[model samples]
Structure formats: structure tokens, C-alpha cells
Target chain A: MSECTKLEMKDLLPDLARGALAGPALAALEDHLATCASCRAELELVRAAQTVLGATPSVDTARIAAAVGRSSSIRRDATVAVAQARRRRAWSVAAPSRRVWLAAASIVAAVGVSVIASNTTRSPVEPGPAPTVAQVEQPSTPGPTTPEPTRPAAPRSTGRAELVMAGGVSDLADADLESLLRVLDDVDTELDVEPAVLLPVLEGDV
Target chain B: MTEPTRDGEPSDAALIARWRGGDERAATILVERHAPAVSRFVASMGERGEVEEVVQDTFVRAFGSLDRFREASSLRTWLFSIARNLCRDRARANRRAPTVVAIDETHLLSSSDPLSAAVATETESRLRAAMERLTETQRAVFTLRVAEGWSYREIADVVETTEGAARVHYHNAVRLVKEYLDE
Candidate 1:
């Protein structure tokens, strides 16, 4: 037999024993192996191995599923543990700052308490008598009893526009202002519509 | 709550979205659905003591990195990948310890008579011993193929090897296992 044929025969021997060969190929391989004792022994060994392997119990799907469930739980706990560890690390880093803030707040509070205590320990100062309203109404007293100095101006008539513009204001462009007023008027008119018809129209708009 | 979607069952994608939106039920559903697969994978790899804990860690890691998981493979496959890595880490950590045969007691009882089962267990123990004798890569290739029934291509993808190399490993593994068994 040719070298290529020998090689093909060796590969085919396993297939033949496994019943994987078919048609003319099976016939040719059978004819070659009939006279080949070495090939026959190899085929027997391959067959035995296949049988042994085939007899291996099919892994239990339920068991697999159970294992998968266990795996998921383990993974979840690990993640939670890792997250907890990170939180612990972060809290550790923040602890000194928290103490510093507490110290600062305590210092401020202590100073405040000391100031209040000092103020309370001292004697209270007496005040002069309060001024009468009639004394305050006198505009040109020029003495200790006189009211604080004032800049006096003559009263003038205030128009509606002047009162409206008293607060610093923008004069909008006429067309834009008119459109805004028209929108507001439309909104008012729409609000006056009956509830029944307004509902569908509002729904449609939405 | 809104009515169930037209498909009867909400898709995983929908469930994922709901979980992301803070639906606790969705999170629970996801956990209940996929946790067993991870557990079985770790168990098959001979993990014990804290198998459930490992499974939980795998899920939490998967959830935290759910954003990075670009649906390139099925969700199960993705989870398996995560689980496999976790198993590897656990295996490395325990390399110095004496290996323990942690076969399920019930599985051992249900497997034929006590004598035959004991012998089978011995054989399995031998097989495991032989497995230990092989390099980690060889054991991984052999287990993923023989135990998990992965195709060579699938093995290559999981093990990050060329397809041709995977085939060679499979052949090598078969030969080694047979030799070990015969002994």
C-alpha cells in the first residue's frame, strides 16, 4: 500500500470501529484492515476507549443547575463583601476629617460660651430716656433732641406709567409684548371653556 | 406590575434590563436560573468546603461586569467562562494541600454494589491520581473533553488553543487516560 493510503487507513480505522464510516469508503477501509493485524489491534483499543468514555454518566442537569445557583449566591456575597470593604476603607479615610470638624465646632462653641459668660458676669449699662414722637416730628430742632438730618423735596403727581416703571424695568418690543398679551388672553378664554369639551381637547393637545 | 410580555416568558435580555432598573424579583430570577450551572461546574472540578460560596462569588463578579459581557456567546457560556477562571484560582490556592477525593457520597452508593462501587471508586481514584500526574493543561483538556463532552473546537475556544493543537491534546489525553486505566 502507498504511504498516503497507510496514513488514511490509520485515521479511518478509528472511524470504522466507531461505525462512523459509510458507503464506498467503508468498504475500502474494511478491505484494507482485513489483512492488517496491527491496524486491527489499534481499532480494538480505540473501540474499548470509546465504550468506556460513552459509559461515563451523563452529568446531572439538576445538579448542574444547583451548582449554578450556588455559584451565583457566592458571587453575590463576594460582591457585597467587596463593596462593604470599600465602604469601610472610605469611612476610615473620612474619620480624621470628622474628628477635625468636631474639634473646630467645639472650639467655636467654647468661645461662644465664654463670651456669653463674660457678658453675663459684667454689670449692665443704663440707657437715656426714649424721645417722644412729637419731639421727633420737629424737623429743624438743631439740638441734641433734633431728629437725624433729612434731604427734603417737593411732592409731585405720580402717573400710572411712572409708578409701574418705578422699579428698574425693560420696555419690551411692542409686537412681542402684544403677542404675549394675546397668548395670556387666549389662555384665559380657554380656561373659561366647559369641563366636558375641554377634557378631550386638552387630551388631544397633550 | 405590567402584564407579562407577549412571549409568555420574558427574555433574558428583558430580565436583565429589569434587574438593571432595580427590579429585585428579576435579580432573584436570574440567580435562581443560572446559579446551579456554576455550582455543578465547580463541583465537577473537585471544589468543596465552600462550593456554594464560590458560586456566589462568580455570580457577583458576573453581575458587576455584566456591562463588559458583550453577548458574544450564550449567557451560559459566558457564565461558564467566569466559573472556570474562578475554579482555576481556587485550584492554584490549594496546590500545596493534599488532594481529597470528594465524590458525592450518594453517587457512590447508587453506583452498583458496595464492592463494585468501591472498586469503581478505586478506579476513579486511580484515574484522578493519573490526572494529577499529568500537567494541568493536559488534565484541563482531558476533563473538558471527556467529562464535559466538548468538541475539539469548543475545547480550543475554552482553553484558548489552536484547533489543531486541541485535536493533538485530545489524542494525547485519550492515550494517557487509557494507559492510566489499563494500569
Candidate 2:
């Protein structure tokens, strides 16, 4: 309760309760306990808790060990299988680092708000006035790629590559685009993995 | 069976390396040494029904991810953290986790006499009740320090709080348990 005059020894009540104190420390605690009513009561509380919660319930360790062994064996086998499968698919699979993932996330988030979220935007990191770098070129008409049931077919291509890729990039916005442009300035690795990851996230978040 | 290896026996590090090298018995020894404390901690979290299961899961999960474990850190604290997380997940799945509260139960001096065994027996149920009333983090913070005499830093590692926050939770738990006891 912090009311004990011998306040410094109070934190050690649990140790005293566990019989961890001995020699000079034990003597010192005893001397403090003889005078401090606050600490004595706290020590009592500590003991009561020890007695109540300290009773270790029996657990079946052998059973658990056997289960763990089986789990480990299965996992090892599965890992081996996965390694073989990975070797087979090594050409298709690209595991990006966390830094790469964050950069990609920034790009995806920016795309939903702005049309300018593209790799070509001039990075502020480079010294000079901002260049009129190519933006994520938008389809001027932006006609729905899928013709509406009520409307006739959209004009051919509408000068947009979106019609070919199912329009994932066009659906993104501007807020994260600026960030993507900035990150593109700093971390160039995201550029290599961008085309692979950007499409799926755009479809999901949009 | 719950007793740890005595002073002259192989250290936890050696056992861990052996276990990593596929010595199954080392895993068994680790389980034996840590199961009791893990059981007590899980039970204190008010997840009493699944204490054994949670303990088993803790070891299994820990063993599975031992490669990620920092080699020099205390394995016991790491196991405690994993058990704490498993219990929290169970509570979340059950939708029974109470929000953390800072309880103040000051001025509960019960005549200052040394507590007797009879009193300890009588208060056992109340103590259990008091423990149940504590927030999960409080119980996690309190039990490790009180029952095991762990440092606040160790408790912090288990409970996922800074050492200062662990100290505050420990005191708050002490006060709350006293309040429950007085009632």
C-alpha cells in the first residue's frame, strides 16, 4: 500500500513470501517487518496468493510431447514438399522484401484517389525543378470497359490500355499517387515488382 | 515432474540446441520444466478450462518457431509471451475479454498480523475470484512477478508492456486483489 515506513523493502514482499530472501537481506526484512504494519499485511497477502495459485495442476507432459513430435514430423515433411514445389515454380514466384511491400502499399493506396499515381512522375528527391514526367495517363472518355446493359458498346480502345487489363490502374485515386511517386524516387526496387502486385491490390481495395 | 533440471544439469540453451538438432527428449525436458508455471499463468487469466491445452499449444507453437527466437533471450519469458497471446486469442474468440482497468484499493489494512495457513485456506476461493476480476494484462503482469518473483522487465516481456507500465499494472493488481479480499 506504500504506507509502510520501511518503504524500500516493500517491493521484496513477494520474494519474502517465496522464501527467496536469506542471510543479511532476510535479517533486514525481518527487522523491517517487526516495525512496519503495512509491509506485514502485504506479506500476508502475498503468501495467500502464493498458496492459492501456486498449486500446480498436473499436466500430461508425455502426451503433449508425443503430439509435438508428430506435429514437428508432419511440418518437416510439408516443408520438404513445399521446397520441392518452390523449386518447380521458382521462375513464377517472386517474394518481395518488407521494404518492397511497403512501397507497393503506398502506391496502391495512392492510386485510389488520384490519376497521377505512376512511376514516371518526377521524384522530388532528384535535384531540379519538377519535370513534366508522364502521368498515369487517363482515358479521356473513361467509358466503362464493360458496355452497360442500357448503353451501347464503348468506343474501341478509347486511347486507354485499361480496356486490355480490365481497368485496375484507372480505378485508383490521387492521395497515394503522390506518395508512390515520392517512394519511387527513393526505392527503385518497387518498380521491378510493381506491375505484378499493383493490379491485385487495386482490384481488392477499389 | 514439473521440477526444473537441478543445478549441475544441462542448461536450457544446450537443450534448445539439442532439440533444434532433433533430440525429442530435450523437448520433453523443456515441457516438464516450464509446464507448471505456464499452467498457473493460463489459469490466472481465467482461462482455467483450457490451461493444459494452452500449455501444450504454447510449447508446440514455441518449438515450431524456435528459429525466430533470439538465441540469447530468456526462453521462459518468450514462452510466457506466447502463452499470454494464446490465452488472449481464446478470450477474444469467446468474446469475453474485459478491457484493462487501473484499480485503486488503498487503505485496506487488515490488522497487520501475519497471515496464517487457515486464513490462506479460507481465502483461496476469494483469491481465485479476485484473480478472475483482474484484467487479462493485470493478471499476466501480476502473476509472473508475485508467484515467480520475476523482475518487472521479465513481466513486461510476457505482458507486452514497457517495464514502467508493468510496474503500474502490478501495483494496481495488488490493490484490486486486496479490495476483493476485503469484500
Candidate 3:
């Protein structure tokens, strides 16, 4: 006897049972349900199902809060440990400038050999038909016309070593300075402490 | 009775300030306030064992990144989104859980509360079992709508689905759940 079909009631039945329908729609559902035995039974069934569903046990709040509290502690500890490990790993990698300096030192040594070989070729040293000193040193030679390779190489290596040492020294100085600043801050904080009341009495020899 | 620090539920901003000002108690309050609904949503998805863990994770993650919360939506909405993601992760890990079939009534009836745990007494367990059969989005929509009683638009935002899609899922889920229970 229902005018509304079962298919239309499929989704709306839940809403109807929930009392969400209003005005004509509510009347229409009511009118339909009054006539249709099957739809009426179906609505009852849905209502019953919802009742049981709504009765699903509430979660134990205390237990959940406790779990959250425990997890928070665990997370904080894990994060701190990971950060410390990353810092340790980062410091152990070779310094960037050291690699650059080593490459520059190799170039300087090659150029020095070139200069030494050129110098020997121009000297008054007599040789039988053996290979010239220039030819003997050819593989090590940087190039022709580059003068005073050994002189430049010595200063260049010295400068590089100085730069490397300066970098290391500055890093150590920063750390030392930071530590000193922290100690000074601590001392300043301690100095700000209010003196005991007995201090004035004792100082006055009372 | 003790009154809250303010009237009509403290805004998330107030709770966050109290939390940042070294109030461990405030953190506990926030956890207690949000955990039940978060746990319910997770549990409604049939994640019984890990529901507590997921709820905890939701809060811890939410608090850690509280600075990023923008307040575009309500704090509860943001928290629900976090909880939903965690639930999906749990659901994805195990595709299905065991269900109590009609034939398995004696097994369930013997082990649980006699009145409330009867196979046909409440539809919650059945609905939950039915939800576990749905795709994650559908289940999320169903739980948010039916269990938490959120609007379709709210469900959409929390689950990052379109409002239309959420409505569709809700309808589909309702139909499936009804059919399952009726059987």
C-alpha cells in the first residue's frame, strides 16, 4: 500500500529512524510505512540495528590517555637520540677544504718537477748520447715556460696548510668561546642570587 | 565541581598556550578530551588492539606540529584527520579481520556478554564487521557519519574526499550495513 518504493527508503530509512526527516518527507514516510507491511518491518529492523550499533562499547578513556602519555614519552626520547646520532655522523665526514688543498698540493708538486727538469736542460752538464734530463723529467713536468715551480710550490703548500690550520683553530676557538660564555652566564645567574639575611649581621660584627 | 579554566570549552589556542607554558596537566587534559572520540572512530573501524596506540600517535603528532595547524578548520577536525590517517594505516596493514558468522554465534555468545554480546542484540559489532569489508574511504565516511555523527561536508574535509563522494559513500555504506544486518 506504500506509495514510496523500497529502493528510495534504502538510505532514508536510517535518517528517518534517526528522526532527521521533517514536514512532507516525514509524512510521506509515515504514510508509506502505514500501508506497506514489508517497509514497516524493514524500518523496525533498521531501528533495531541502529540501537545495537549505537550500543557499541565506549572506549576506556583512562586506558587511552595513559597510552598516549606513554607514547609521547617514547617519541620524545627517540627524537633526541636520533638528533644526537646525526650530529655525530656529520662531524666525522672529512672537511671539504682538506680535499681541495690535497688536490692543489698535487698540482704544485707536478709544476715543481717541470721547473727542475727545465733548469737541468739549460745547465752546462755534459752527457753522452743518453736521454736529456728534460726528457727524463718530461712525465713529471707541469709544462714549459712555467718558472720557479719549486719556489711557488713551497709557499702554496705552506699557505694551504696554514689555511687548514686556521680553519681548525677557529672552529676550536668557537667551541671554547661558547663554553666560556655558558660558564660566564651560569656565574652571572649565580651572582644574581639574593644574599642571606645573616650576611649583613655578620658583616656588621653583631 | 571544578569548572574549566574558561567557559564553553576552551579554544584550541588557549589549550595550546597552556600546553606550551609547561603545563603537563594541560597536555593530559587535551589528550583526555580528544582521545575518546579518536579512539571511538578507530575502534569503530574494528581496530581494537592498536586503537590506543593510534589515538596516542594522533595527539603526539598533532601537538608536535601544533605550529603548523593554521586553524583553517576546527582543532577537532584536524585531530580527526590525523586519527583517520592513522586508522587507514592500520587497516592497510591487515586487509581483513575475522568476522563472527551466523554459524559462529555460539563461539561469540559463549565468550562475551550474554545480553549485549548476543549476535543480533546490537548492530554495532555487525556494522563494524560490515565496515571492515568496505574500502577505507567508505568505512571512514561511515564511521564519521554513523559513529561520530559528523555531517557529510565535515566527513569530506576530515577524510579529504569530496562532499559529493562522502554523501555517496555514506549512502552506500548505510545500504551495505543494512543489507548485512538484515541478513
**Top candidate by TM-score:** 2
Docking class of 3: incorrect
Give the per-residue lDDT digits (tens) of candidate 2, residues A1-206: 45664435866788889988889888989998998887888888888787666766667888878877876776666566555555544523443354467655544544433334222222345443321112234445466443223222444233233222334433344655566556555545423433333333222221
- For model 1, the stretches where C-alpha displacement exceeds 4 angstroms are A1-206, B1-18, B21-33, B96-106, B109-112
Question: Residue B8 of candidate 1: its Cα lDDT?
Answer: 67
Query: Per-prediction TM-score, please?
Result: 0.44, 0.63, 0.55
lDDT of 2: 0.68
Q: Which ten contiguous residues of candidate 1 chain A have the minimum total lDDT?
A: A161-170
- The CA lDDT at B5 in model 2 is 50
Cα miss at B130, model 1 (Å)? Answer: 2.6
lDDT of each: 0.54, 0.68, 0.59
| Ranked candidates, highest TM-score first | 2, 3, 1
Ordered from best to worst DockQ, the candidate numbers read 2, 3, 1
Who wins the lDDT comparison? 2
